[model samples]
Target chain A: MKFVDIITTAIANSFRSKLRTGLTVIAIFIGAFTLTITSGIGTGVTSYINSQVSAIGAADVLTVSKAGDATATADDGPAPYDPDKATAISLGNGSRPGSTIQALTDADLGTIEATSGIVGVDPAVQVTPDYIEYDDSGKFELTVNAAATLTTADLAAGEQLDNESTTDQILLPTTYLDTLGFSTPESAIGETVTIGIADFAGTQQQVPATVVGVQNETILGAGAGLNQPLTDRLHAVELSGTPAGAPQSYATATARFDLDASDAEITAIKADLADQGYAAQTVADQIGSFETVINVIIGVLNAFAVIALIAAGFGIINTLLMSVQERTREIGLMKAMGMNGGRVYALFSTEAVFIGFLGSALGALVAVGVGSLVSNILATTVFENLPGLQVVQFAPSSIAIIIGVVMLIAFLAGTLPARAAARQNPIDALRYE
Target chain B: MTVPVLSAQNIGKSYGSGANRFDALKGVSVDIRAGESIAIVGKSGSGKSTLMHLLALLDDPDSGALLVEGTDAKKLKGKEVNRLRNQDFGFVFQQFFLTANASVLDNVVLPLKIAGVGPKERRARGMKALEQLELADKAKNKAMNLSGGQKQRAVIARALVNNPKVIFADEPTGNLDTTTGAVVEDILFSLNRDKGITLIIVTHDIDLAARCDRQIFIRDGLEDVTRSPEAIEKPAGAHA
Candidate 1:
């Protein structure tokens, strides 16, 4: 028979027993729906985290520090502290508690910069500012870190930090706008703010900087950011009263390599750093741990969805088997009319594929609708503090892939029954009661 | 002098294997010409149906050659055989195996559909066949809704739709009443007479067999030469 005719006939035959076909479709629907939803969740969370990480614009940068020796337990009477390793730096957020490596000094920064793959190194300068005061507001305690040269902060208003500019510049967080006596982020731009810092001898000094920008809050970035000039000015003022013998060291530092380097190349660079008694972590490595956990959860969910699909596949087999049984005489008649065995198999298999198409298309379409609705509702309620998060998101390609996979499963499930129908002896089938 | 449309030469077919094997058609041979109505008449299990199936190319013979249009069927590939059957033959069974949920027209156009005829032409040809059977008005009705006689007429329409060189009827009127059976028998003979289509009917009724131009008696899986066409004709009314 013509392929078109076989398809139409198979579609018609599938609906002959509507209840059975409908039940089978419902089973497949459950699988497709769950699969789509879980895949959407994976896409949603990953994209959100990716957006946050990209906004920080530190993809190629790696934080490097002197690798600390594995410390002794509390019962070991605390290993003798070396004065050279006085400072400890915490790797934030995803790292385990007390996962502190030793500080990076000027010598360590020079060593990192001298490494073959390292293009630049920025030592994390410790700037302790006592307070930041505006025109009329009282002084407020401040936490400040110099903005990395490579980072393009997620800004609320004004331009980025001008690291090359001679004048000191500061980028305030959005939370400081009202407290800094500015009605809006834009109004704070180009205005001067005083940062008070205490020297090592307890003498207080004030440094002035122009507010160049206001940045939005992000999970990875905390406190205000200072440009190079501002950090240099603050460091110079605080050092004026420092005791001559006081040792100086940086808590942490960032090392930059070629952005387009391959993963193996990047690993080699890290190994090189490790050989120099330093440990390095790329930005992806820092955020990747969280993503890994999320992926494991999503992978588990996907496994359940696959199990459901396998069950649905069995339902398709059962449905087609019964259909073949009920239509034995019709099959015999068709065969007698010169419809070949291949055509007979195509007829039955097309019915199965059609069923799969209906269930998956409906399931994916409904999932997109329902998932979007739930995402919108959750975004407004549960995830209100997270501005750019969508709890469930769909990619068109992923949806198409899901439907295709389900259809493949259905076609495989159908082969058993289709082969049975095709292999039937026409004369015996005609005589079938 | 014309080549017979179908010629079976000592074709043998058996069922089962080893000790349980039973010969359904043992060295049965026959030739059917175009435009002739021939009957293979026998009682149940007399191998009449087996002979029809082999002649129709629905099953392969265990031995010997079955020829269609003088070409040895054994030499043809499975696909070629299917094409030959689809294009050159039609079938009607007593069971009236119309798809119950499908329209009568759908059932009639099945052969044309199998032959990959386009929808419009298939419909036109199907309607013409149904008109010949006087079932044009019932074309849209589902097969299950048709009466017994109407169903058999629909089956006849299906057989005629393909415009085959030969029609194989397996007890075509066995399920119909005498009045309807006679109507169906008249249609089959008329097609043979007017269209020059070969007719091969398998039946047990001597009265039905007598209506054919010739009769072949099958007994014990082989042709029964003792009961000739003259004997079959003479006893046509006695069996009724």
Candidate 2:
């Protein structure tokens, strides 16, 4: 008969057995719902990671470090460098004088800035030293501090150090300022501080410096506990002039470049730095350990989601097969009247798909509600101290994929049952008790 | 003068193979004309139902040529036989065989649905068929809700929905009371008389067989035309 008549008849017949029909629909619904929730979670995680990566200029920044040396090497190789060992060497307690393989020099930064795709370059220099600071109570306390130079571009507020100036002016990150009882960035600026500097010869010199700027510290540094906001542990200090002593121990040189460089262009820049006896790494390589951890977490979550979806599919099949058995006689009557095997198959399949659609729609609604509730609970309970962990959001692509997957599962569930119904012999079916 | 609505020649049907084979029909030949009501009357296990099935094209017979309205049934494939059943033959079973879950209208329109008619036309034809059976008022009521008599009438309406040339009733009134059986018989005869349709009924009811224009008697898998008088005679004190 006409498609409309066949579909209407099939739907009408299904409802004739309300409990069976409802169960089948529920099966499809579960399948669709699980798929939507899992995919939505995946989308949320991906989006969150992407945003965090963007905040760190992950898409544009690349890092280069010394590869293989007891301490620092110019070559880009794998070596676990320990700052404690460098400190021991500086204290002359180690037999092997730490090697001074400068990875990136001013010349390397200049060369990188001159590269065709390169827009700007800044050399980063860092050294961590133990400083005894007298607090307001006049008690001398040994505090571990990282002395580094950061550019104006990297600073979230205030200004960078003057490249040609001999003045002892430096920028303090907000974390360090917070620990020092400074309420705001403006208050932290112009605060004079004294640091004890020691040379490899074991001679110490006291230097007075004024905070010319304040900046918000990067999450990487914060998460590493290097810049404890409550402890005011790390400080960014600019060297006024070169010290007359043996070569410095544990130096870090960082360079910033243009954002739009392609992979090939980045590789060329790395090669030029290597030619100058320097090691190079991309931003992704710098965060390789973090990325691995994130991937493992996402992969495990997705696997669980897949298992749930499979279970849902089984549920659908069971429901649909039961439905076919219950409606066997009705199917036979339709076939006898003029409904070809194909029409009968389509009718059953269409019902299955509709069930799937309904289930998925319900699932999506449930996911949104559950996701919102979970996110709110997480934000209020576990993530209260953390910023930017409000609600999990999914992309439109995720929505489409979830719906498509649910529909596919539903179709598969209905297919075999429909075929069984279609293959039934009319005479045998009519004779069925 | 016109072609016979159904003709069967030397039709033989057997179950199983080789030893222990049981033959349901033995080279029986019959022709049923248009506008005539005929009955095949026999006791249980006789070949009457088998002959009716062969006439309705619901089953194939070995070593026989059967034709309906000049179309060779023997040459038709499985699908073609089903098409013939759809377009040329209507069947009424003893158990009513109405789709119990569906409404009377849906049960009647079942044949038209199988024919792939559009909804509007299927409904109109189903309604017309129900009207003819005086079941129009019960159109929306489920078949199971109908009385034994009304259920049979609904089944008859379903059979007539396709307007087939031949109506095959295999013990159509077997499950009904005597009053309902007589009413069903009247409806069948009226259909044959008014619409010029062929009616072939298989029953053990001799009175029912006697009401038809002609009666065929089947005994031990063979037609016994000499026993036609016995087919006509009702049992002593038997209720009609």
Candidate 3:
């Protein structure tokens, strides 16, 4: 018979019992729906991670830290202190026990900068601000973390940190505005605040600074940026407070590499740093860990979808087998009318593919609709801090792959029944009551 | 002088295997010439239907050959046999065997569709066949909605829709009432006479068998062709 005729007949035969076929289609629908949603979730989160990586920092800049020599990895554990090895320097609240380390000195900084592919290196200057006050709202002590080369920040109000200025400009966190007695974030920007620290001989000293911006604190970036000259001024005051002959070192250094450097070149640079007893990592490398975690989660979700689909495949086989049994005489009639075995097989297989198409198309459409709604709600409410993020996103190629895989499964499932119909004996079938 | 449209030579067929086996036909032979109207009459289980099936190439005999339009049907592959069935022969059954859920027109259009006839031409030819069978007005009705005679006519239309060289009817009027059976017989005879197409029928009705141009009787897996063409086994109504 003609292909079109076979297809029409298959479709007609499939729906002969509407309820049975509809139920089978629904079984397939559940599988397709689950698969589409899970795939969309994978796409959305991976896309979110990509965006976050871009916003995190410049691609070529690597964070450089001195290599430790077999120190205790435990956070609360203690080990024998080696004055010779580099350690993380933690200066804490007064009278509180804090760890000090052999920081990267001028010599070590020069070594990192002189490494091949290293364009420049800047040592992170530690700042220990004693107190801050706005006009006579009593002085409150505060601590500071060294700023990353953060050019752009998600701001509540005001411009970004003035990295271009040598003058002492600061960006204060939202929590600080309340402590400094500022009425609003907008009002605090461009306002001058005084930072008081002890000068050389345990004497009270004060430095006036302009607040250039006010920003919401983020987990990745917990502190404020200080211009080069302000960093120097703070260090100068800190040095003056200490007695002469005190050793000076740094906690970490930031190194900028060639913008167009190849992966091998970057690897070579990292190797050189390692040889010099230092470690370096680029932004992509840092994000790689995060990607691995996300991928594991998506993988698990997709596995569930696969299991659901396999279960649905059994539904197809059952439905087609029942159809073949019910239509035994009709099958014989068609064969007697001259439908070849191949044509008989095609008819039944086409019915299966049609069922798959119904389920997959319905599932995909419903997924896109529902996934978009869920993503919007999440972006607005739960993931507000990470803006421009969709919690569920669909990719066309992934959608196509899902449909193709399901159809292939359906085809396999239909094989036994289609073969049964194809291999039916015409005389016996006609005689079948 | 008319050529034989189809012939069977020592055809043999059976069901089951070994001790449980039962032979339906054994060395049965028959010839159906073009434009001839005939009947193979026998009691139930007498292998009349088996002989017709072999003649139509619906089933192959284990030990004998079948020829259609002078082509050795035994030599044809399965695909070629199917093609031969669609293009050269048609069938009607005692049960009518109309798809209960399908419309009359769709039923009539089936063989043509299997023949791979295009939709327009298939429909036109199917309608023409239905009109010839006096079923045009009922074409849109479902097969189950029709009376026994109407259903048989729809089946006949289907058999003729492809304009086959030979039409095989296995008890075509067996289910209808006396008047309806007579009407179906009239249509079958006129089609054979006017269209010059070959007709081979299998039936237990001696009266119906007497109406054909030639009569045949099969007994115990073999055909008994009497010299006289007036009766199948004995003259009609002689036993009655």
Top TM-score: which candidate number? Answer: 1
By lDDT, is 1 or 3 better?
1
Candidate 1 segments exceeding 4 Å error: A55-60, A71-84, A87-99, A110-120, A126-135, A138-150, A175-185, A193-197, A201-208, A235-240, A257-265, A287-290, B236-239
Clashes of each: 0, 8, 0
- Candidate 3, CAPRI quality class derived from DockQ: medium
**Could you arrange the candidates by DockQ from highest to lowest?**
3, 1, 2
Interface root-mean-square deviation for each candidate? 1.1, 2.5, 1.0
Best first by lDDT, ranked: 1, 3, 2
Model 2 DockQ reads: 0.41
Tens digit of per-residue lDDT, candidate 1, span B38-112: 999999999999999999998999988999889999898988887777778888899899899899999999989
What lDDT would each prediction earn against the true structure?
A: 0.88, 0.67, 0.82
Please estimate how well model 3 matches the true structure, expressed as its whole-model Cα lDDT: 0.82
- Pairs of residues clashing in candidate 2: A1-B116, A29-A359, A67-A77, A124-A254, A337-B114, A338-B114, A338-B115, A339-B114
Off by over 4 Å in 2: A24-28, A55-61, A68-123, A126-243, A249-280, A284-296, B16-22, B74-83, B229-240
Q: Give the TM-score of candidate 3.
A: 0.85
Candidate 2 lDDT, tens digit per residue, A1-433?
6777756765675576677667656655555555555556656655555554443443565555443344446685656764333322222222147644444434445555675555565444343444523234231323322322211223545665553455565556555655566678787666666556554444555555566666544333331012222122122232334475523433444555557777788888788766645576766665566667766765676676667666766766777788788767666655554456887788888777666666677777777778778877887887664445544665667767777777687788789988998898665566577
lDDT of 3 by residue, A224-281 (tens): 5565666678778877857666656787778999899999999999988988888788
lDDT score, residue A234, model 1?
84
The chain A TM-scores for the candidates, taken one by one, are 0.88, 0.66, 0.78
Docking class of 2: acceptable
Best by DockQ: 3
